[model samples]
Target: MTFAAQVAMFSKLAEEKGMVNSLEGNLSVIDRQTGNIYITPSHRAKCLLTEEEICIVNPQGEQIGGTGKKSSEFFLHEAAYKARPDVGAVVHCHTPYLSAYAFAYRDFETPKDTFLSQIFGNIKCLPYGAHGTHEIHQGIEEALDGRPVALLGGHGVVCVGEDLEDAIGIMEAAENYAKTIAIKHKLF
Candidate 1:
């Protein structure tokens, strides 16, 4: 599928999973062949995204192509891609359950749930960093050294994968994992 189609699909998925409310999350895909990156615009609702609103930027986070302002968290995407060549897409979302765990849990490894274990092997929590700041990007890079996903302390979750679908799947699995943990804790 085209990058725009993938972004739209993931955006809807984010909304369905309540990972984002209004315009809270962003999605990006990198063209491995061209070193180009396609991403959702800043401040646009994930559920209401459009092709024209997507921004295509270079690996350096420059506006090489596309419409609309790039996401303020573009550096986070850049850092992840730069750190992991296998990563084709990156998702940053305020998935409630995951975010809750991020603030509450210090070392949240893969959940006991089979689906979570299969999808997101483990979730590392990066130290708190200012949103959209260089510190946030740096924190992500350090946390993702060899991991596919990381939770930003008191902020949100970032998932990277070989493709957009995989990245989105990781995000979904993370939220489910967090929800399962919450339910289990309540039951105790």
Candidate 2:
């Protein structure tokens, strides 16, 4: 699939999952061969993002193409890409249930469900850092440590994968697992 289509698909998925409302989350894709990064723009609603709204940045974080301003969180994507050369795409979102766990400083244990286990592996919690700051980017990079997903304290979650679809699937699985855990906790 084209990069634009993947961006649109992820935007819609984020909206559908309520992970992002009005541009609260970001998605990025890296061209492994060329080191070009494509990402969603800041300030645009995720549900309404179009192909043109995506921004292209080089490995150095310089905008080379596309429309709109790159997300302030572009540094987070850059840091992750630099740390994990095997990762091709990253998805970051303020998923409520997961963020709740983060805000509470509770590590999200792997859910007992087989599907969740198979998909999410284990999600590690990272220290709190200022949003859009280099510190937060570094924190995420450290948290990755070869893991596919990491929960940012008092912030959100980041999922990295070999491509856009894999990244999105990880995010979706994490959120679903978090939601299920929240429901079960409420019941007990």
Candidate 3:
């Protein structure tokens, strides 16, 4: 599947899994061959997102293709791609369990589960930043420091992976892990 299609599909999956609402998340995949970034558009419903609505931007964040404007949170994707050359895709969402931690300004501690601990190493909640501003991306690299997922303080979660499937899987795992923590604390 094309990167655009993959993004559109996983975006819908995110919505179906309660990772994001219709207009509340963004997903992007960097074409390994072209270096073009295909991302979800701003102000669109993920549940109904289509491949045609995907926007393309160069590595420098300039629009080079597609009809819709790039997402306002494009800078976060840019930072992740720049910081981690191995990352081919990014998934950002306001999942209820994870966002609860963001709202509380709390970081996650990897549970005793061996697999979860290996996959997620104590996700950090970066300091709050104003959306659509550079402030929102400040310290993002450090927050992502060798980790696939990071929580944007008072914002949401951002995850990176080698590809669209990998990114989406990481997002699902992260959300489920957060839910486990919430259940443990009776926060649900």
In the range 102-125, model 2's lDDT, one tens digit per residue, is 898667888566777765666778
**Model 1 backbone overlap count:** 0
Backbone clashes in model 3, listed as residue pairs: none
Give, for candidate 3, the lowest lDDT window spanning 10 residues. Answer: 14-23
Model 2 ranges off by over 4 Å: 111-115
State the lDDT at 137 in candidate 3: 67
lDDT of each: 0.78, 0.81, 0.85
lDDT, residue 185, model 2: 84
Arrange candidates by TM-score, descending: 3, 2, 1
Clashes of each: 0, 0, 0
lDDT of 1 by residue, 73-150 (tens): 888888788878878999888877888867874646765667657656667788777888877755666667677788
lDDT value, residue 27 of candidate 2? 90
Model 3: lDDT of residue 184: 79
Name the top lDDT candidate. Answer: 3
TM-score for each model:
0.87, 0.89, 0.92
